[model samples]
Target: MPQLYLGPWFAILMFPWLDFLIHIPTKVLNHVTPNELTLVGTEKHKTESWNWPW
Candidate 1:
């Protein structure tokens, strides 16, 4: 038998890879951008200034 232990902070590190995992298949099958895949069915919002701090 195998057991797995995941800490509370695991998701913080795992989110990017998890997002990649989900996006790759969707991109291959649906030919959509990761942004599009993530924002599907959601209203588009204005780009935030904080995202570009330069």
Candidate 2:
């Protein structure tokens, strides 16, 4: 049907706008500093450590 076809067509056309919208928040809020990089290891010291607790 045209409605079903239109849905995908609209989504494909709008994907870049949607992606830009999604990227803004992550670009703004997901940056880490040099101090953060240095303190990334060791879960005992940094609560936000990139380690799996086991």
Please name the candidate that would achieve the greatest lDDT relative to the true structure.
2
Candidate 2 local lDDT, 1-54, one digit each (tens): 687778788988799788888987677666643235454556565467588888
Each candidate: RMSD to true structure?
19.4, 14.2
Candidate 2 clash pair list: none
Model 1, CA-based lDDT = 0.67
lDDT of 2 at 37: 42
Query: In model 2, which range of ten residues has the least summed lDDT?
Result: 32-41
TM-score of each: 0.30, 0.30
Q: In model 1, how many backbone clashes occur?
A: 0
Give the residue spans of candidate 1 off by over 4 A. Answer: 1-9, 32-54
Predicted structure 2: lDDT: 0.72
